[model samples]
Target chain A: MNTHIRVAPGDLFGDGVFETIHLRPDGPWLLHEHLARLVRSAAILGLPEPDLSELPAFTGEDIAVPGVDPGSDVPRALRIIYTGGRVHTAVTPIPPAVLRERRDGVRVITADLGVSVRRRPPWSISSAKSLSYAENFAARRWAVRQGADDMIWFATEGYALEAPTASVVWLAGGELCTVPPAEAGILPGITAAHLLSLAPSVGLRAAERMVTLDELVAADAIWLASSLRGLAEVTELDGKPRPHSPWTPRLLTLLGFPATS
Target chain B: MNTHIRVAPGDLFGDGVFETIHLRPDGPWLLHEHLARLVRSAAILGLPEPDLSELPAFTGEDIAVPGVDPGSDVPRALRIIYTGGRVHTAVTPIPPAVLRERRDGVRVITADLGVSVRRRPPWSISSAKSLSYAENFAARRWAVRQGADDMIWFATEGYALEAPTASVVWLAGGELCTVPPAEAGILPGITAAHLLSLAPSVGLRAAERMVTLDELVAADAIWLASSLRGLAEVTELDGKPRPHSPWTPRLLTLLGFPATS
Candidate 1:
């Protein structure tokens, strides 16, 4: 949605952190988890403590929309942004492309991000979801130009890291696994963490492993997990096509996401 | 100076480009060059061409500042920020720290940035001064925490790339040299470029060369060049003592910057 707000000039320099939470009719999905992660991100950027206790007080009545019934069950995206200047929150309609990726799959490619996970600078902000997202957006634009839906990044040592805005999740030998965020120096994906926690309920095992790109390509199924998209299976790797996964529907059900394509 | 502006929610995403120009008593320094670079940066971010024709008409009188004379010759900083939402220009007083660095030089350290020039992604935004400056600020903070004033980045290949917010320049064998912007995949430094053009007039040759960190350490002098800082000599690097260079005053004179502390 097109929304405007007054911001200090210093706030535009990207010295801030943000969290995008999926909004449900009941309330914001994983609201506590998202808020806690927001604080962690703020600390990483050296920002002062943010007062988020006032967030839950905001009901649909507090925000005015032209035609949106905030009380409706339609899924929305709530963005909480904090900088040294001030704290801001915005609610926008989830983009149609995200929905499409969830329904259909995504064509994915692997690219070397040229960074060594072991040698990240002392003050590196890689683990923080900072507002400095120009590179992330640029990488996605490059993927689109190359006829791919998204891209996964690998480190110089050939270890899979993460996607620009999501975590890489795969299934191999009946085990659900994701890359360990701290070891990989990548942002921890809250959705991926939540999904892994539910794996046992679905009679599956969960693990965190560091795998080479070659090993990842050999996985039984690969998917990118995030808040908005839920999960987008990697139907094609590089240029090779892979058949649809049988677990996609079951996992969607386990995650409480509607899989009505 | 602290200033407030009206911005869109999207503007806080750091998906934009900016230019900081030195405002002189005559006018903004290198106004046309900075504007042209801003357009180039916008193109790199896939943003539409920004109309900057109205910027030149802004005189200090148009902005209200307390406890200051608009007619005075005090130097100011003219920051032009452009995002998907709109174009904003702000005039603020130069920070005292910047002036101190120019006069007394700076202590710096060398750190591996973990990025390889050979493997830069197809959509690398390093050539554009986008608003993703969190990493830059973080690097400086890291330096300060380590008892230094700034930091320089070296590639995994052992070649000196550039500083987080400035370009690396040095003097050796009677020549003024800096890393070539395109070859090094770094943002072209307007100040460094303009200074190189005046090297011949000061009896020194100008050249672009890729040097390793070891080679940089052996140079007669090393400096970080940028818009606001102009040039800050590396007085101490990686705990090694570097005597004040005799060329510092001469080069500052050639660049039309005051050498007086």
Candidate 2:
């Protein structure tokens, strides 16, 4: 956890981009995909493309030093933050709340985000994961205040958009679906996209389509997908109880994520 | 400028609130009003109430120190930034761009911000001037890229909203008007509100009304008011030139701002 970086006070305005990568014993998981999406997010923010060569490679040697507990199955979390002044990375142990959600699942509530897909400003950075995350943090805080673990946001038109920090993915019949990023003008979720790419390999059809809250609730199973959290199943929607799905374990394994507690 | 604050890397998320005040030879202008608004903005972001007693006071004597040209007519800028870590303040020279806009005015374009007044999320931080200003910066950048100095945002229902960093105020005959903050769910502009309060002294009626873009375009004159910039007149709207209004200079003077270049 020896992180080093210097930035001006103005950088706190969230006028930057960042990526969170799952750090396994082997190395940073899906490093290339995360880097690519980081570049894309920077472009959306009108920032200069980041120099990938300048990034530090996550070598497994850090976890394999003599006397270290290499036998431990727990994975660390890696975060790369890039502001105007500097780029830096940090590694920290994943919090217990994330593990709890993965194990016992979470209750999720849906609310209107009040954003109009048709009226996105010309410089709209909605599709970019910029650092201006107060609203996102506020949404999660509101969920916690409401006695829920997380919340899903919907467009003003009533289309299910995304979670504050994750992408919404669901299983409906034989197809695995997520909201189309381009159509909804939301940040394209790298983990969700990667999982959708592997859907065919798992003998499941994948589709990207706009869905309503009602339609999402009627789905066979729902999960909030992200790089670090991997996949946290939705055990309840609003106040209604939802049955646990057997597919949760299978999908976690498919994504190279640990399924056991 | 003497600044002595040090913060950690995690402080750059813009998950806080800020206020910019006009520093005059007399003292920091509108100090109490600015402090009050800062507290309100912090409340919107769910931050603990700002302890005003803990803040540094920028007295006129502090600016009268040797080597600080005592006769300089240029107004200083005071900014207060509060985040999860701490609250801090700084004094700096106002940007040349802000002064230029005051003298020569600005050309503005109107774009739909795509947010719904009635449907803001439970955790919506729109009414607060939170530190997560990436989108605000991006919106201004977008306006600059589109061949305009700035932009006026419209709600999804076609009602004229505020600017990226300023409040929209327009003159209609004898009435001075601004958008209603509660009805529109916009950040209440302290400067605009103060100006409206002074309208009666200048023999003009003042009001807060929900105006359409068309109505804004048809106004006698329109200006975006903020702490740093004072007031910037919108000389052009959607590429159409507007007739110069005599009240621009009169109002600036009425509000105790420098009336000439």
Q: Which is the leading candidate under TM-score?
A: 1
lDDT of 2 by residue, B121-235 (tens): 7688888889899988999999999899999998888898899999999999899999999888889999999999999999999999999987998899999999877789999
Off by over 4 Å in 2: A1-5, A61-74, B1-5, B61-74
lDDT per residue for candidate 2 within A1-261, as digits (tens), equals 444344555766789998888888668889888888888988888888787777666785553322336566555677778775456676666678887887778899989888877777678899988889899989999999998999999887889989989999999997999999999999899889999999999889999999998899899999999987888999999978899998899999998987965
Q: Output the lDDT of residue A149, model 2.
A: 94
Instruction: Give me candidate 1's TM-score against the actual structure.
Output: 0.96
In candidate 2, the residue pairs with backbone N, CA or C atoms under 3 Å apart (3 or more residues apart, or in different chains) clash, namely none
Per-candidate interface DockQ score: 0.85, 0.62
Interface CA RMSD, all predictions: 1.0, 1.9
What tens-digit string does per-residue lDDT give for candidate 1 at A129-212?
A: 999999999999999999999999999899999999999999999899999999999999998999999999988899999999
